[model samples]
Target chain A: DAGITQSPRHKVTETGTPVTLRCHQTENHRYMYWYRQDPGHGLRLIHYSYGVKDTDKGEVSDGYSVSRSKTEDFLLTLESATSSQTSVYFCAISESNQGREQYFGPGTRLTVT
Target chain B: AQTVTQSQPEMSVQEAETVTLSCTYDTSESDYYLFWYKQPPSRQMILVIRQEAYKQQNATENRFSVNFQKAAKSFSLKISDSQLGDAAMYFCAYRSARNQGGKLIFGQGTELSVKP
Candidate 1:
């Protein structure tokens, strides 16, 4: 409902391979975030971008990288996939300066074997 | 550092009945925000309600309301006249009003079921 869409809704990749998930939003929100959801550990932020070429690490930023060149697109890349990286990745956007109500994308499920 | 905790792993309620989900957070900052998000089987995250720590009065939206006790650091969600659509995993999250860039810290989550 927030005009957010995630590409490659489901993906399976072998260990040590490179994978990248894309999040595209039409709302032109100023802040975009990437998160991973796993059992027993709610959604953990992977990385986030406040504006073009500006990014910051989150609670769980290891083994992942992100880049944003435009306001509508945010990309999360797993340099080398691992079994531990297998989980559902979500993308969120917020218009405010502080973390407030964030609209989420459909989510991408990536599997590393 | 801020943390959110949802003690209940699972809960069930009969349709048309009222059920409350518990959530507690630890934060040194006095001004912040608390939110309740519902993720149904479809996995779509829906915002149920939100409460600003600065506001003394609780926030409500239709059937969903929150009990915010800032002093106790407690935030709970109450669903009245629960329906089958309410069956989902509920998450409590905290966001600092300071310079966190709106980054949210989420709880473990509670799976709620509504039985007919």
Candidate 2:
């Protein structure tokens, strides 16, 4: 797990509730990414940031949103959590956005009931 | 669209033996990169090995190596001297050389079990 850290490693929440996961990095990497892992789907990108206040949608960005306000903090928010959104979320940082070597955090396991 | 395929869903190898995991990718782009990632029970995605499409030489890292065939669009991971700690889910990924956000496309994944 590189120098990245994610809060609330495990959480059990109710459906329709809102949730926000935080990813903090000690390394001043320029790129940050948010991904989700499920049983069948290996891992799908939810969102990514190139710099502070810059973010973009991924393949599965429908029910999720992300924000990066500083060099070390990237946040993922689920405005309205759903059962389908329950999955293991991972945060990664890379020095370059060219898809170079990315260091991942431990991961946050969110469960929606 | 680029796609990665890991044919083997599950694989077993004996301790101290060797095993190979196959991965094939479909892409029209000529320049890109291929990588092998390991996700153990701890659930952290670790970079196992990487190979650049332009590089002809195979990439080797300690106990892990990769056989990259650009012509056939194939990249396989070979683990030598397997250990029980090697048991984990391995994922094959592809990244285009373009500046198109640099998103990684991953295969379904193959679960590797090391039998002691």
Q: Across residues A10-98, which tens digit of lDDT does each residue of candidate 2 receive?
A: 99999999999999999999889998998767888899998999999988999899999999999999999999998999998888856
Predictions' DockQ, in order: 0.70, 0.67
Chain B only, TM-score of each candidate: 0.99, 0.99
After superposing all C-alphas onto the true structure, candidate 2 shows an RMSD in angstroms of 1.0
- Each prediction's Cα lDDT score? 0.94, 0.92
| Residues A1-113 of candidate 1: C-alpha lDDT, one tens digit per residue | 89999999999999999999999999989999999999889999999999999999999999999999999999999999999999999999999857469999989999999
Q: After superposition, how far is residue A97 of candidate 1 from its true place, in Å?
A: 2.8
Reference interface contacts recovered per candidate: 0.49, 0.51
lDDT of 2 at A41: 74
State the lDDT of candidate 1 residue by residue for B1-66, as single tens digits.
999999999999999999999999999998898999999988889999989899999999999999
State the fnat of model 2.
0.51
User: How close to the true structure is residue B40 of candidate 2, measured as C-alpha lDDT?
Assistant: 95
Clash pairs for candidate 2: none
